[model samples]
Target: MGRVEPSLFSSTSDPGIDQANRPDPRAFWVVTFAFVLTVTSFGKYEISRLTPLFFYPVTIGTLYGVSARALLRKAFFALPFVLLVGLFNPLLDRQVLLEIGGYSLSGGWVSFFSITMRSMLAVTSAILLAMTTPFDRLCLGLEKMRVPRVLVTQLQFLHRYMFLLRGEALRMVRAHDLRAQGNKPRIALSTAGSMIGLLLLRALDRATRVHRAMLVRGFDGEVRVLHPLRFSWSRDGGFALGWILYFVLVRLVNLPEWLFGWVVGR
Candidate 1:
């Protein structure tokens, strides 16, 4: 049978074996933490400097068998919010900072561009993290890295149970569709509120039963993984160290300028 597509919030869509060749989730977590820290550390107008940081997401995507196009497409959904946040930058900071090809560039526009680039990098990093690591493994990694147990447990439960909530919603919508009047199938605003209330009650009832089932199955508030994670020094350590070194180098060096000068024999 073909692979069954999962719900939006469901993360175990694919088998964990798919990530076999991938680095340990904890290693990915470390690098992601460092990557975000480095990307956001750049100044407001340092968009050019941030270009090299794109290498992290691109490289990680490639390594994890995710295409650059897919990563960018996923990251694109977050840009509108970022744009909204930076919308007033150009209007408020009109002081010209430089001229490029006779076109004056204001500090506001420069900062706006910088903000957008940073946001894209950050979002891309996060998307890559989610793409490469399964939700269960990610929570395990977080717990290993000293993240609070309560938070990790909550996240685990949220991811595991979101599919149940989605199924309940889908059933309700389907039932509504079957009962509604002919042709244009739509939920009336008047009925939507009641439907939502009904969904909430159904969700609570479902959650209670699921919790009882889990308790019967020996769920003692501890998340369990089918395949326990083991940190490999040669593999995981090398992967993290290599990326960390590259990030540090990129942060301290003007790579584009250096490449240009080298090409020109300067």
Candidate 2:
């Protein structure tokens, strides 16, 4: 019998490592500013003001080749949680706080709407960051920010193994297909059970192999990355200053309401 070929799915790895090289400190600063502003905006319940914050990351991601659709899909996963909390707003807080000609609205309704909007903004910003920043560099950034080395190492391992697990799973599926040639597959509990068992077995084997490879390469459960992170003065300074200005303008200054009024007028 012909040797079972490596699964075609195994060949399809994550996109190229073009994003792995450390981003310019300027780029990192832009992302950091966007992240802090976005998170802080969400925390303060500044719904309308947060809309402008999306532009930074979206612009960066667009330039950096991150998929908009994929980022939005990640945002979609949070919808249920947002809705669950938001639904209570209209029901619990029934007192009318504002009157616009004839429409009456409650504080709860306003708060809820603000929460939902900010939630979407926050989640989208996070997704954009993850998409544009390679996971390893992100961990390095965290390490630089004083995140514990243990946590960073765990994150690095998880990201690397996730891709490996995906490849292994694909190989198992292809092997099953090859073995089941000309047989009508039964869609039943028994078949499902067998498939799960086979998948687990193959996954364990792959993990063992990966662990051995790591040990051979002198991995003592600590990842030693080659490029040590270096902060650039001009780029990082400019980036930080931009974020400081943004925070001052958006939070400290009264810009959001004015911007909202202008948009509505237009």
Candidate 3:
């Protein structure tokens, strides 16, 4: 008998890191397509008819080896808010839509589940974008698209601060944990509120000092990129357009449903 190779042994490169390191104009198109697809997921012509086309991004993303775990984690972590907001759907709309596996499903439940699916797909698409494109490149891509310079600079600062803020918050949490009595692990709401206030104060203080330092260092308000966006439209324009066309097609046609029907010979 021939020896079979393990699936893990077939791995080659990490696509997420590779994509982020490579400066490609095509990434903008990919992000645009993903966003368009996500938006279309919410456009339900009928309450019961949920779109499965959104999953196409996941399929493509996996092929390109995006960080599936991080994407899935973020999506799932954000799902409770979607569920909580949509909770009233089942209560408010009681009209029965269809029967599935001996159980009746109402329109509200159908829509609720559909919304959940949409959120998951949308969030996954965004995570894939972040994983595949460096934050600086994304801001540059925005600039290439003729976005305002001030807005792009603000975005860059905001992106930089997201990491700083998270790091600061973690340090604060660690300090809190060190002082806290492990025997009684629960933190009261009032205590949490005070902690939050303190965190904000520290964050503001740090921001002011950083701003003053930047001013002292002869820093202007312009955001400069080491490797600016370089695009050869003749080479990459058609490639972007092709993806855009596919996006439009997907929005117009429910490819999954059509394929299923074709496969079943309906």
Candidate 4:
């Protein structure tokens, strides 16, 4: 699963649309599966062949109401690790595959490019799914899709508490800064290490308190959603079929090549 950098609680521009706006969360699931399958099929193609395929999701995501800026920013989350993974490819794969004038390019560079493009496409589409569907609702959707209760339950709790732990850590940092030298503020490396341990201790204490409170109120380790999961054959079924068909067509035909050919056939 890809991580998104945006705030989960931030509302989109259209307040009228939300996780429950559509009758079925499966609509999003269908779209996700189609996109993933399409990307996977591109594995057999090289850089030039797969380049345009990657951009298709960007267009789809934008049409689905995800802003271009958000897509790019979220896509960048996987970039550093992707860069690290491909860093040695150019060095190790030195077989010259292309020559332009005096400059020669190796297979390593081509493979690295392909890897980077795939990474960006995968991460961006995953982020788009998150942006379109609320996390809790997605978990419920997963549960509906027969995903294991334990996995969904853990994911729900982790998402719920990440913010709590972040807030606590920030408060600790603020207090430490206040007590330190104002003009030339700096913490000793040993002190910094101790603060990290202190942060974990504080997080644990907070978690225990929250758990006790939940138990006092009769929490049975189940997070409940207020709305019922609705499914309509007319809406959700057609929606699923439409997007899945589009993905299938794109997978079978080189859409970019076809479109280019169509444009030039005057």
TM-score: which candidate is best?
A: 1
Tell me the tens digit of each residue's lDDT in model 3 across 1-266. Answer: 00111111111123325443343634554546556564555553233233545445666566555455655665687888878867888898889887989999888887787777666666666655555566666667778777798998897777656555665788888777778887656666888899888888887777778778888988799766576666656545654565566666666676777888899995
lDDT of 1: 0.83
- TM-score, prediction 3: 0.79
Clash-forming residue pairs, model 2:
none
> Which whole-number lDDT from 0 to 100 does residue 98 have in model 1?
88
Clashing residue pairs in candidate 4 (N, C-alpha, C atoms within 3 angstroms)? none
What local distance difference test score does each model get? 0.83, 0.64, 0.62, 0.72
Per-residue lDDT over 27-109 for candidate 2, one digit per residue giving the tens place of the 0 to 100 score: 56465655665456554334566666666667755765656676676689999998787788778878887787999878778
Instruction: Tell me the spans in candidate 4 whose CA falls farther than 4 Å from its real position.
Output: 1-17, 20-23, 54-56, 100-102, 182-188
As a whole number from 0 to 100, the lDDT of residue 158 in candidate 1 is: 83
Judge candidate 1 at residue 238 and give its lDDT: 99
Clashes of 4: 0
Error of 1 at 253 (Å): 0.6
Error of 4 at 155 (Å): 0.8
Residue-level error in angstroms, candidate 2, position 141:
2.1
Model 3 C-alpha lDDT versus the unseen true structure: 0.62
Roughly what TM-score does model 4 have, to 2 decimal places? Answer: 0.83
Native RMSD of candidate 3 (Å)? 7.2
